[model samples]
Target: MTRITMREAISQAMWEEMERDPDVFILGEEVGVWGGSYAVTKGFYDHFGEKRVRDTPISESTIVGAAIGSALTGLRPIAEIMTINFAFSAMDHIVNQAAKLHYMFGGQLILPLVIRTVGGGGRQLGATHSQTPDAIFAHFPGLKVVAPGTPEDAKGLLKSAIRSNDPIFFIEHATLYQTRAEVPDGDYITPIGKSKVHREGRDVTIVTYSKMLETSSKAAEQLSGMGIEAEIIDLRTLRPLDMEPVLESFRKTNRAVIVEEGWRSYGVGAEVTARIYEEAFDYVDAPIQRVAQKEVPLPYNRTLEQLALPQVEDVVQAVKEVL
Candidate 1:
């Protein structure tokens, strides 16, 4: 086992996958010469050459369209959208074409395509660039949504998404690229659509993912000082969201606090809270609470931006309210 940053883990996953499968290639803005906007594809251009690590114009639609075309021709394409906010420009192609192609063709086609993008409200990227619209994409069928919190999951999940014969939208937190964690030093892949328990506790179930996972973990530690043991469940995948672990945890604690970097209304927390009540209502000891970004466009000012985004204290308070 070795400790590495999230960026390195993601880079290693793509590197290994491209090396393992010749069909796997990457295309996006600044992926080649700029080494990716977030530097996740650093050194890929030189290593894979222009034929494989082809860079395209600053057009999200063109990038996604090209990837879909190549995937239809039996090539595994990893399309990078630079940022999640820009994904809206290619929404038609992503949701209509890439997602429904295989089914529309009666399984005669396989879109082994992965759309990689970064998102989150930090680093002062302003309102337009820093948005976590993961739930919106997950709402559509035939599109797998994955957002990892740790380096290990990031590496493994990316590998699995590349191999799956389905369209996948992989979201990476912009602020978590520098976060470090211990990862397995091997050619292994983590299955998509599985939620894993990051910390075990019997007090209250704290469910979260992506950048919010880190925030929630910190809040859990703070809650410990007050004699509160919070069990953290990372919903690594959003679309095929696994509720077994979440339900099981809620069954034990009889309480839950769903945290997300996005807004609270109709967000991930809302969906999880609904599912828990629907399946595990009998185990409810208290009303579930939600922690999420404020209902406003993220500001450019650092102070205002942090104010709008969910914080550790917000999570702690939400947990207490639920408990």
Candidate 2:
């Protein structure tokens, strides 16, 4: 085992996958010369050369379209959009084609493509650059959405996404690039649609992932000191969401609190809260509480940015309300 930052972990994951599979190649804006917007692929250009690590123009639609075509032809293409917000420009390709092609063709073809993008606030990158859309891609069927919280999870999950013969949206937290953790060496991969019990508790279950997982874990620690044990279930994958663990946790605790970094309405929290109520309503001792961002355009101001987003205190309060 070795300690590394999330940025290094991500870079290593893609590098190793490309080295392991000759068909795997990456293309995106600034991925080559600029080393990626967040430096996630800094050395990839020189190491893999321009052929494998191709850089495209600043067109999200073109990047995604090219990836779809590349995938159909047998090349495993990992398309990187600089930010999640810009993915809208490529919605046609992502939603209509890449997502529906396999089913549309009666399962005769495989679309082994991965879309990598960074999201979440805390960098003061303004509203356009730092938006959390973990739930956005989940709305569409056939797209595998995942957001990794720790450096280790990032490495493992990315490796799995690249190998899967399906279209995947791998979302990364913009603020988590520097966070460090120990990642095991050698061959390893995290399952695509499994949620882990990050911190087991008895009083309440806190469901969260990605950047919010950090906040939820901190809130769980604070709750523990107050005589309330909050179990943290990290929903690493948003779409094809695994609810078995969530139902089990709610059945044990008899209370639930969902923590998400996106908007409160129609967000990941809303979906999870509804599922818990549907499957585990009889086990609930209290109503499910949610900790999420305020409903408004995310402000660019540093103070306002923090105000609009979910905080550790918010998670603590939500947990208390549910308990």
Clash tally for model 1: 0
User: Which residue pairs of candidate 1 clash?
Assistant: none
Tell me how many clashing residue pairs each candidate has: 0, 0
lDDT, residue 49, model 1: 96
The TM-score, computed over Cα atoms with residue i paired to residue i, of candidate 1 is: 0.99
lDDT of each: 0.94, 0.91
Could you tell me every candidate's TM-score relative to the true structure?
0.99, 0.98
Question: Cα RMSDs of all predictions?
Answer: 0.8, 0.9
Please write out the lDDT profile of model 1 over residues 190-296, one tens digit for every residue: 99999999999999999999999999999989999999999999999998999999999999999999999998889999999999999999999999999999999
Clashing pairs in 2: none
lDDT measured at residue 221 in model 1 versus the true structure, 0 to 100: 91
